[model samples]
Target: MKILSKNLIKLRDIKTFKFKKAMINYQHVEIVNHFMKKPLILVINCGSSSLKFSLMDPKTGEESLNGIAQCLLSDNANISFKVNGEKQVLALLPPFDHNTAIVELVNFITKNNLFEQITAIGHRVVHGGEKYHQPTLITPQVKNEIAKLAKLAPLHNPANLVGIEATEKVFSHLLQVAIFDTAFHQTMPEKAYIYGLPYNLYQEHGIRRYGFHGTSHYFVTQRASSLLQKPLEQCNFISAHLGNGCSISAIVNGKSVDTSLGFTPLEGVVMGTRSGDIDPSIIFYLVEQLGYSLDQVNTLLNKESGLLGISGISNDCRTIEEQLLAGNKRAKLAIDVFCYRIAKKIASFSASLDNLDGLIFTGGIGENSNTIRSLILNQLSLLGFKANEQLNEEIRFGKQGNINDTTSRPCWVIPTNEEWVIAEQTQHLLINKGM
Candidate 1:
């Protein structure tokens, strides 16, 4: 506890915090209680308009408390949380920002004395650019770097920094760690991540493929490697993270060799809102020939395209599936495009591997929607992935297990625990730094 006090004192002086010190892990070493053995790690992820948090046991992957502040900064802003097993919802009055939300959450934690045993806070930052490649202790300069990366990921990185800054003020004494979603993909080789554009654009603008959904892909890869009874460093597979925002990773020997998303997350397969892979010419055409501005073209590609764009309805797969059953042709077309694009990407990623060991499905649609899985697997029949009809039908609504038949390569529907990944990385860094 004395050492903890001394180390945290350095953080008190903002002017003295260096960039190099920000790269090092800051841990508070104190004799812990023998009665309650496990230390708690708080993981936080902020979307453009929502904040999700979890209090977890990093050693056991156990979550004691988890929740989300949804519809943030709006009239309908509310927090839905679970304590142990019981669930509760608290509505916040209008105009609640991240700072106000943090104040409320901190008060709740204090009322229950939850912060007394917390060892560290792990924040899920989306874009690290070329500056950060691993988890780092949060500092003022590190926060500024995160803010600067907002130019690359406007919808995500800035909002992530907000959560980090708010949590810093609330839990000022505890160590705060920033875990980048792009960190796991740092192992990707240049040949796989490079674009075919002008060399100067790549050198000067930092415009190269930086994949997203990395933590989820990494977690599911580890789980799949374990289930296959092979060492993680010896496993090869394709990981498809199917959610509102989706990406597929080609992991060879447990390292991400290639991924679907590029430069930004807008260059991959079709997502809920984003038009994943439209030609660059279309943007120029829209601006010059269709009388639209650059900003409007950007909005059309990122917000008005993909599933919603095709179906002329909701971006949700479930809703589209319902409409497909109701004989909606556009809805069927939307789903067909979604599944086909994923299948094509998975097939293409297999070319990057020497030999395929397995294929993993994760995230919301991958874990829950059996129909989507079947649609995708049916297109990959040439690759010997025969998803068992009964197994796919059985695993629904968060149930995870193998969904392949005897003659097929292993296909797993593992529910991803990205928060657990963040906590594990935080703990591993602490151990490596001899905290």
Candidate 2:
């Protein structure tokens, strides 16, 4: 009994010593983080089949890490990234999902000694409905609200929620903020958002046009304002975010007064697969005359239409452009329809503005495709837009500059920075909330 008691006392003493040492180590880590490390925000944007992440210094707008996990939940799932300008790729094993992807990302950050500097996590939520008008800190109620709004943005919100939940588990000690894509468009007026449906239906069902890609739009708007040397509130321009998914917004005094995307992303200009602005009667005709179930019709419109449907080739603009160069008639038709629709939408949005300052273009197609830009600009000659062929051709592949002639209004190719906007907003929210 005496020997056993002595051993127990020794065990207790050792535990106490270890505890004290751990506390000292923790204090040292805190001191180093405070003095040596700049607070970095980890921005996450999760799609249905992909997850994009970036570790950024919000103050300096410098990205330490940028990557995407593509083809999730499949055998070929892999992640490609650049850490401090060095590129690398890693394949994931089977049974990987968002949670697994996040864990791997956290492990990668820790391995590279960058985890200690990440002070918070920011999620790019696609829908905030009317509940969130700005960047909001995530809570249980907020999660529920985002989930509910998935009905409005099925392809986006649920994935965003999954990312948020997974990130919460992996970074339980860090603050998580949701920078919504719809939040910046909340400034839109009632007349601009209201539909022509019955008043009660809109009021009761919460069915109104809620714009998407607001983060991208807001980012380019700020850049345009800066380039034009005008205050944000004084800048009036039409910003087009053209990619696989397209939306155009009319910015009056830096606020979105009207936008092409309506209650859903499918209501705007033609997208990769979505049939934007189809006659409602066509849906009824497909159902009653063509023998299509509602689900099948939904799939057809959202997944099998647009450039792919018109070209009968591929949804990718680059591929379509190549085919057009090869004198493919269907490809020409697809390009013509795409450019005409966008140009028509831009002209319509001009009615919402008193004086057009300039035109801004950003996104995948907008930034890279000078051919499409020139084609669209040619259609807008009446609006005083004359594309400088040399300048337009030069300002692509991560280049940003005016692509307009000296006598015409400015047309810019500002690369959109949605991730930076998310990071900066997350930092600002933390500072405001004293977190």
Candidate 3:
């Protein structure tokens, strides 16, 4: 049975909170969860410009508080947080980087006495190269290895490590685990992962497909199997995670047999900004034809392409949808190209698995946009799939609902909790050292 209810965590039942608050008011001192040894774990997803955190009970699946510190390195840095079901805004502050952002979180946790209960921390490290196949405890050596992978994922790994270092300094006594985005896709066979490039490049530079969004893809597939009441080993499906960065995964049984993302997130479906699955010659062509330098070309592929490039308006899917509704030509073009690429990849991934049991949509765009879902399903009636429009629209955010008809192949909107997946991995890998 799941530990948390569908509703918000009741604040009144929290004996610790009431007791601590009462003590603070009457006794003028902070109270800690010193009596309990069960750890209050912190799961952190450190991104380039934002830090998302959650305090979760691993065994119970109940969460205390979760929130995001966004717009880092800006004058208008903001902290948007939610405890139970209520949301609050913290004081607006100065510019902060990942390190400073994490330091502030540690301060918040400590001032509120959360640090006393925390026994460990889990981090979502973006790329693990070929070294880490599973979640491993973060040691000095492991930290160095992760640092080395900064070039492979310059946009993510470096910032991820910054959060790790800052948190380690504050919670030096706690056990910490590093969960990697590429870990779940390590099951991909060479037949599915290896590129047709020179064998020497593959051996020398570790240049091969390392699919991302592993945490989200892994958890959703397991949950889908449970929802269908089928053994995951018997389930063959394609899972799509369509946020700013989009990826499609082909799961055979319980494991990821194949996925759309390659060595970088840039090698998949057209995303919010990244040019996905582009021809290699296009990079060279842009340099010669447009008189662009390598940095200029790289910036175009990574930051100037995708929806933002097509629309010339916004990076957000919701904004694009709004523009599309208002009949903006560029917005319509951006969306058309996005869905077309996704539909094309869905077909290619389905071919990887001989038997297709279902197509699951997730992440921001995949979970919310019934329009996108309908458009994709329109081209796939041959596969006996059609999304239930009402259900798709109703349960767009954090609510679980299937979009497929009773006889149709299963399509679900299973809200993702990558933080929970990181928490689970952290717990499984660590033995309780007396807290």
Candidate 4:
């Protein structure tokens, strides 16, 4: 009996040893797999004459490197970036195009030995039209479709295509994905997207509301959902992306139901340079009565308007704020108009939501400007958004928090991270494609 009991104990010890060994082996394999796998995503946002890039870790939302190549195809072209919070600027050779800028970016990445860990490239395509509501792998056909859609976003799609083609030439071995800024708002219903114009125009010409800043809106609204400890599908909020190009979205139950910007980004609230929501007759008046050419009118509205036009100062809100403090009446008026327009838009958007979870402020102006936020919220008192003045002032310079009084509905200052959204979506597409 004693001999039999000792044998049983020996067998149990062996089994426990084997189980511990198996766990160690499994952990070792996981660690090795993590190190071997390429985990970094290169996110690119291309403007007409600039290229912005970020090396991002999708899992942790960490940006290993961030940079921009500006003034491309000009003598003054330069690439500026930060590594480990240290800023550096390098001059690009003269007459460099987007392709050249990308080549330089690749060289920099290789020099830093980050090229191998970068698994894919994510490009931000400004307008995807009615076709793409999700991130897609960049194929030849997709490129052609993006080119064909350039007429709808003449200012952005061509530039975005340039970035894609440039990256294809530079990073041919890497899988690339395109994330559209207009994709999120694709969930908006027909009533929200359709114009009061003729039905044939909507069917044939596709001349209807396709909202911009969808990427930012999606990022902020999702963050709001997380912060509120509520499921996204149950949350309703109004997200205002007040940047150089501003837009407001009404997100109901995790989807964009209506937005401020329509047909073009110029249809929304007053922006840095855009003459938003201008009367259609104004264009005719400029051409027929004022002897202005159509090209000139287009340039005037898109370039020579907004805060700059109103203040006769800078288009930057920071500068406008400084001037306002110095007793500049036009600066004051510019800010007042900007805040008032946003407030009005917020109130109007409330009608879209059955219940308001919160009001989210994101983008440059929305995140940083406490004064503007206070002004906007003060105007929204009727909607139960009484700002806690102290809380409002505390949430700035990338600090996010709820800034509303206890008696009021939540008013949050959430910083939007569009690049992270692009990175995440890019990673998701790669996984689903089994790449």
Which residue segments of model 3 deviate by more than 4 Å? 1-38, 92-95, 432-435
Model 3: pairs clashing at backbone N, Cα or C within 3 Å: none
**1-435: candidate 4 lDDT, tens digit per residue:** 454344323323321122232222323323333564557899999999999999999877899899999998888999988889998999867888897788777777766767656778999999899999999999999999999989999999999999998887656556789999899999999999999899999899889999999889999998999999999999999999998889999999999999999988889799898889888999999999999999999888998889888989989999999999999999999999999998999999977988999999999999999999999999998999999999999999999999999999998999989999999999999778766
Top lDDT prediction, candidate number: 2
How high is the CA lDDT of each candidate model?
A: 0.86, 0.88, 0.80, 0.87
User: lDDT of model 2 at residue 390?
Assistant: 99
- Evaluate residue 256 in candidate 1 and report its C-alpha lDDT on the 0 to 100 scale: 92
Model 2, 36-131: lDDT tens digits are 458789999999888999999998779999999989999999988898688999987877788788878877876676765777899999989988
lDDT of 3: 0.80
**How well is each residue in 1-435 modelled by candidate 1, as lDDT tens digits?**
565545444433333222233422433334432224668889999887898998889988998789888899889999877987888899989888887777766656655556555678899999998778888988889998998899999989989998988887666656789999898898899998889989888798888999988899999999998898899999999999999899999998899999998888898999999999988898888988999998898898888999999999889999999999999999999999999999999999877989999899999999999999999999999999998999999988878789998899999999999999999888787668756
Better of 1 and 4 by lDDT: 4
Candidate 2 whole-model C-alpha lDDT, 0 to 1 = 0.88
Q: Give TM per candidate.
A: 0.92, 0.92, 0.88, 0.91
Candidate 2 lDDT score at position 360: 95
What ordering of candidates by TM-score runs from best to worst?
2, 1, 4, 3
TM-score of 2: 0.92
How far does residue 393 in candidate 1 sit from its true spot (Å)? Answer: 0.6
Ranking by lDDT: 2, 4, 1, 3
For candidate 2, the per-residue lDDT at 146 reads: 96
